[model samples]
Target: MKYFRANRPLTINEVQKFAPAAFADKASLDVSKNYSFLSTRNLIETLEKKNIVPFAVAQTKSRTDEAKESGRHLIRFRHENHKLEIGEVVPEIVLETSHDAKSSFKFSLGLFRLICENGLVAPCSILDTIRIKHVKADDSDVIDAAFEVLDSSDSAIENILEMKRKVLSIDDRFSFANEATTLRWEKESDCPHLPLEKILAPRRRKESELDLWTTFNVVQENLVRGGLSFYKLNDKGYPIARQSTRAVNSIAKNLELNRNLWTLANKFLNN
Candidate 1:
């Protein structure tokens, strides 16, 4: 999965267990000679001192052991000391980086929705992130990016309130779930075999409400966490065999899907 979540701050051993490349001492091969290695471990340690803790971490999977050591990683953080008592949904900052030269050190806003117990990656920059090349970046830069994110409690609450206030009709909810299927399974896949009612089903009592936020969360959890059932088609377009979907495993795809879902949720905002 994209995240190895923890109830408490993780130790170096725990981090490496899930994302060893976070401790990589050098950059991946084929990069410019000037490309410097930036240790995600060091950055986490620095942020820890500032009361920001790494609660979740993950690295890309590899077919070969050698490639595994240089995989990209993403670590999600929260402030332990100055944490906001935001009831069900708390904010988090997610930072993605790599030694493979595939991506830069990207920082973005995330949310810890305790109601469903899932962490959401907010598409907008609630806390502004830096965009410079990783080679010239320092530990202080991440700290600054984090500080900006933690400073925006108002916007976070406002966004959540907007979703909660908007109620959805049955067709609207179905449309939301349908678009989500395209987002998750891609437009070309046989995702239509998956029923909208299955995606719309609530996992808990609170989620049974017809609010947009609840429906969005319902579709998101079902899509990302998998578990729903479907079937592949035969050459004649008939049912072939039964199959269950799989949870998102890649850190890169996880972030992309989450961001797209967030953007999808926003379409309701202007309507």
Candidate 2:
């Protein structure tokens, strides 16, 4: 499994060379000169001040290799182990993506449990994302967002511990899985009306824990990266049980699912 696709960080000059169109024209030059563009150097310097360093940087290219859509800089912060909780902390790269022929810049925060290293993006309800339009990009805002995420770590970690303490009953697990299915499908009619036994089946024995935290992770992984298989008719008109692929869905789906699941967990704790 290749976690970090780009292992080396590309300099701003190198990035400009790789995608000259992104830096072309007088407007681009003005943006670049004003430090309004969040370059790799800016990201490196901001993170380094907090003692966080990027381990990998991947420059994603379009299908035709004619354009660059985004860059992913992977960084793993030092894991913290408290008497009540233990987990790995990871932050995602901030980058711009082409949406509807326009550039949208944003960054996400994530976590990986030391017990399983199952990476999950922080739910938006718990942590607000930083988004800046390419035209009005501000370096200060970007840096502030980074600091905000870093500062919220303690609260996030406490929530994780709270979730771990809340054990899921068999019925609770089933209800959670059903809700997960609803969130996974855009349309209610398109959802599979299978038994919770099939839907909540763990991908591995290690994920069989009854705690809300573990159950959430199991369902999350299955939803984002398909795992559980069901029999479906192939072109041959024969039913076959094929294992699901590990490919992830769109960023929107990722954020939606995470937010929904986090909300569900919060409800459980409150009740």
Candidate 3:
């Protein structure tokens, strides 16, 4: 997938370069006659009226010509009320849909930390998932649903606070990182084992904390922006040449990994 992200809201032209699907006026020819065309641009305009503006947008690289303009795309926006202060967790609205009839207008809550690089803070708790089936675009519903997703911030914040309050010992922190590696590569026995230390180290001094929140952020950023090196032994027990993990950009894979990481964090929180 190709994506554009920033601390400030992205302009339509900027978003268009990454996700032309957002501007498509008609549904894909593959859709049935009953399928109604709902433009993502209309929904974005509707939400912007309520001060919910897009900060990041992305789409899959389409292979077929017909799917080029109707492929799945995602827009991540934040409410005007949320402060974009560095090192603080902020709430956001994640919206995804496509005109190919393969996706519906789905809305979910997200959290982000405004560090120098603008790392995403995965949703810590179970948040509402709003799905709108094929229908003519309506502003009122978009506005209401956006606010409803934003309302989930309270629970998200609470979860973050709890994670911060519970401090972890060095060994515990490494354990968390170890589990994160498994989440990234399920059935590690079948894959080259990633070193826990690579993901455990924080990029900034401020992020080096023995708490769940900070630890989660460190691991999440490393796993998502992967360049970690690990060696795997081949059939004869001879080590294969060093290989680096690739950054995850597939929409489905990224979402699944993030949610899995979130679930792993919660399990540690409760124990």
Per-residue lDDT tens digits for candidate 2, residues 53-131, read: 4432333344543333233222333322222134444444333333222344555566655455455666565676666
- How close is every model to the real structure, measured as TM-score? 0.90, 0.70, 0.90
Return the top candidate by lDDT. 3
TM-score of 1: 0.90
Q: Give candidate 2 regions above 4 Å deviation.
A: 1-36, 55-61, 64-66, 69-103, 192-195, 233-246
Q: Which stretches of candidate 3 lie over 4 Å from their true place?
A: 80-83, 116-124, 135-143
Ranking by TM-score: 3, 1, 2
The per-candidate count of clashes, in order, stands at: 0, 0, 0
Report the lDDT of model 3 for residue 78: 84
Looking at model 3, which ten-residue stretch has the lowest summed lDDT? 116-125
Superposed Cα deviation of residue 13, candidate 3 (Å)? 0.8
